[model samples]
Target: MRANKGLAGLIAGDTAISKVDVSTSSLWYRGYDINELCEKTSFLEVAFLLLCEKLPNLKEFQEFEAFERAHRDIPDSLYELFKTMPSYSHPMDLLNQSVSILGSFDEKNTLGSNSKEENLRKAMRLLAKMPTVVANSYRLSQGLTPVKPNKSLSYSENFLSMITGTETKDPLSVKTFDTSMILYAEHGYNASTFSARVTAATLSDLYSAVSTAIGSLKGPLHGGANEQVMYMLKEIESVERAKDYTLKKINRKEKIMGFGHRLYRTGDSRTAVMKKLGKALATKLNIHIWHDISDIMEATMIEEKNIYPNLDFPAASAYYLLGIPIELYTPIFAASRITGWAAHIIEQHNDNRLIRPSCDYIGPNARTVEPISKR
Candidate 1:
């Protein structure tokens, strides 16, 4: 029997959290269309919706925001731990390690139960602290001082502030970043989220599941694509070089880092929203060259191969224009995706069978072991 490669088109399980409708080229979180959510709701509201299974009203939203702000500070020892690591370490690895370390700190709560209440608390804690970890780990790795989260600012503003080591109050920048978070907050069983569910199905603690997800996301084909996309942009570096660079890569049949996604044939639905915001950001920053180059490459890929850009394509330029470091891109993805991953983990724990699947016996069938030196 042939096995499904990478579990393509496999319906592994059911979810009420989100849906990816390829028929419509659309996504919905808790039944709300993503584009509408991005336009009207904050990232915190989306997080609440994903975790609680419904959008929060005003009083509930206020309470949820307060809880998140209250838990933003990780243990100081985590910073000390960050200081001891080599600067050359990848931010994702550091983030993965830091999350496991956080599990140790929360042993009392995490070890006791897989109850939804307990997991929800843990999820909210992870959601709150992940931005701190993503920002400070990168900063500390660069020999800079860690910045504390400013509760006065909104979630997106605070995250940007911590990463850049300055207050991020610009309206456009904050909105763009918040929109990216909402877009990335969830997708139905992408690699990382699936791995997280698999781990959770084993009754693993929330942190371990999240760490497993992070490890999966670190690969180039997944979350790391954003980082690679930025690097590719930098390599092209000029509008004049963009089309030639893209066509050369295409002629060689190289996999363009952010051009295609398996789930969407026409294009990633999230990409258009991000591209518009990214172009606006580029215009606002007086940095048209990146998006200009992107336009040439995007048109070339679609015209030549009928391929379209994914969310990572525009996100790379957006983050670059925002003055974010190339390396932090995937870690930032982790920060946003914690919401989705935790929701999956919670869902899995609530209704789980050990996620062990049978495999096709492709190796030497019915092989016999010979005694040592008997041949």
Candidate 2:
């Protein structure tokens, strides 16, 4: 029997982490609607919900918050490692290497410790330290000094602060970033999450699973779509060119970076929330060009092909308005997705499986091996 290509529509396994209802174009995390979670909670709260299997109560939230803040500092040795690397390296590559290095630092806790309690501890550490690694690695690469994480700020604020090398005081900016994180936090068994789960199913360490996920996310079809979207917008330059540019790409049968998704047909459920937030940021920053260009491009694509913009489409402009570097987009994704990846990793560890899938052997059928001398 022929299997689905890229395992499309294949129910490989079950998950309680998050659900993407493609029919309705809605997403829920642990039974909470993504829109409600964005409006009612913070990214860290969502992280707690994903990992702990429920939303945290007040005391639980406070304790979790404190733990995350406390562990934001990575080793000075990591900084030194970042400094030694060539500046031309991609941030995602640095991030992947950083997680592996971090695994080395916590081998005692990570190795042979797939217990829920231990995995949760490791997960929290990764969630806390990822921002530091992502921001500092990029900073060091740019020949700029790394900014230390400010525990006093909220998770999103501190993340922006570190990336920008200053404390973020704008509430709207912080909220937009937080919402983006929440939206990107989890989606059921996407490529990266599935890869992470596959690694975890082998009983490997949590960091190894996360490293695997990060590498998978570096592709343009995955988390790198956000970065590519930004580049495309920049290439289009202005609103006047947007329609023609989109039509040309469509006519040429080129895959637009952020126009469609494998999961959502009518639309990506996360897009509307992000588009609103992104437009608001555009208005706030007095920079209407990116969104204006995007609006035209979006309309053209829909009218021509019935294709809808995904979350990454608006997110690119949002992050641009927020003053984030384009290349850091996927790494920021990795930083937020560490929560979901860990949750999946922990779940896989709890129900241990080898995750070895069989494939149809379509190579030369019944071919016998012959010695070189005989040939």
Candidate 3:
């Protein structure tokens, strides 16, 4: 039989855009490495690089920031839907639904065909409004009144404050969130983004495409990994007990929640930065339970089985410190990933392929015509 594919370890094609260097722990947008960008650039700067394929000069970035601010507000209907939703609904579901609702609003816009500058503007609205929707959705679920974003805050700070009514005012948290958004901005044909690309290939509305991606992101093996990581830590009571816990799971062949990744064979590049961010947050918050547990888990995993902490390990703690609801972890990922989704959608639209890949038949080989309703 020919090799079956989940496109596992296959080089589909060259993307001049960016590459995720899993083993080396590097991310680049166009040609600028993410570490450098995280130190020197804003998330919007990276977004411009991914979406428009170039760094925005000072004037262009200012114009883009102005445009994003103008579109950050969500419709009242979205707010009502969130308010009325039961606390039981995973926050990501609210985001998915809210994004779909946004599509209806976008449909009413003059840019129906994604053809004019207005269509691009509508896309910007989505990029801006998504964080608002996601943050508000969780706050609503928590029964905490959502705070309107203060334009004075940068995107990350505004998002944090909206989620938790307290103004963190910590520039480090803001910087970390921004960098995670940049790290997550795009990766070629990742699961959720591929889900986005596939939906967009049908010429679906951006919100529909993005919303579908949000749903996929909710899976534990996908964006839900971080939430699961926190849950797992919350399960194990202490660092001393972590070894036995992890060893038992590994021996049973149960997948460790945050220890691995398909794309990053050796390790996830983004994990190191998020881990640093998580440690800092833990120190400031004076709660090292999760971080301490993670340190033990990583040390044990590497010594026992050579497993490494992937992005989700630290992201779980970082988002928790940022006051994100556990269930909304992946939705937040969807919010950040909207950039990648939009980029891939635009790329697919320009190249325009139907993306029909072949599936091999493995069941009964052309079995003798089955008698109708065979017993």
Candidate 4:
């Protein structure tokens, strides 16, 4: 009876924030090709570029590093609140609560207040805080005490060392994690990013906007795809079972998780990169289960659905290799994506437009009847 909106084909608003070059099939932060940056740059380099609109010089990087280090500590009240949380509580839920606690101690509510610089600073703080909050939450969920981020290590390295107490000589984990962050930093109008934008559109605070993203990203259809992929692999178990299982599912019109992508008909661009990483990690792990499972899933999807693996497929295995819990997969996604979300919010604010949308109502006629007795 009416259009569903789906927000499809609707130019609800304009953005110069960052461009998704779907035609060229590339993403650019500000004006630089992200692929080029990823090849030659560190995650911090890319983050600086996204926030400041330029690749940082030595002094700028050093200063930014110092600033990030200085604010690494969450307020005592926030930590106390976290300490009191139940061990069985989801990390995302803990993070949602922590965000509220941190906001309560806000020296500068720069998110909706007057200082643009302070808002930017706050954005950087939240971005830096995400991994800490996640890793710390995990520690709390277990009996272990939460570790603070190392000031000596870079952001990428710090996250790793925090999760694993021992010093790691393996640089690959940090590199891969950072690369994953850059790859997943932002996508144009995805569910979670759109959630952030819509929240910002209402002129709400940044924490509120990003908390909305946490909820949006937790869904199986969105950021949960990676975990779902792993679950699919576990269900199928061996390579031998993959073919029969996938074929039966397809015959029954069942959906295969992490196989078909809504956007990419050819292949997922991030999957192209992650596949390379997955192969390397597979070699390192030298195990048969995941290696064979990933291989077979790719093959099965191609034969039955004609769909290629999206970003989620390899990411599931990649995180597994890094010793990250499957349950925290999407939370890690939020950690990477909060930077992009913050940037998008800032961009939305500068333009200053409310993102109200129109819907074609179609359930009933305009006239209304009274209660049952009166009717």
Which one wins on lDDT? 2
1-375: candidate 3 lDDT, tens digit per residue: 243466677665446667787767676778888778777887888877777879999999998888787778888877777888888988878888887788778755433364424445656788889888888887777677877777887777777777767886787788778877777777776788788777767776566677778888888888888789888988997978888898898889898988877676667777777788778888888988888888888887888788788788888888787767677777777877887777776776556566556776678656477778994
**Model 3: number of clashes?**
0
Which digits, one per residue and each the tens of the lDDT, describe model 2 over residues 109-178?
6467889998899999999999999999999988889999998988888999999997897989999999
Q: What clash count goes with each model?
A: 0, 0, 0, 0
Ranking by lDDT: 2, 1, 3, 4
Where model 2 places Cα greater than 4 Å from the true spot, the runs are: 365-375
Residue 245 displacement in candidate 2 (angstroms): 0.5
Candidate-wise lDDT, in order:
0.92, 0.92, 0.77, 0.75
Deviation in angstroms for 72 in model 3? 1.3
Ranking by TM-score: 2, 1, 3, 4
Winner on TM-score (2 vs 4): 2
Clashing pairs in 2: none
lDDT of 2 at 246: 93
lDDT of 1 by residue, 1-375 (tens): 444798887888899999999988899998899999999999999999999999999999999999999999999998998888899999999999989988888866545488899899989998999999999988988899999999998899999999989898999999899999999899999999999999998898899999999999999899999999999999998899999999999999999998888788888889888989988898887889988988999999999999999899999999998889899999999999999998999899988899988875567768688998996
lDDT of 3 at 90: 89
What TM-score does candidate 4 reach?
0.91
What RMSD value applies to candidate 1?
Answer: 1.5
Candidate 3 worst ten-residue window by lDDT:
110-119
lDDT of 3 at 166: 82
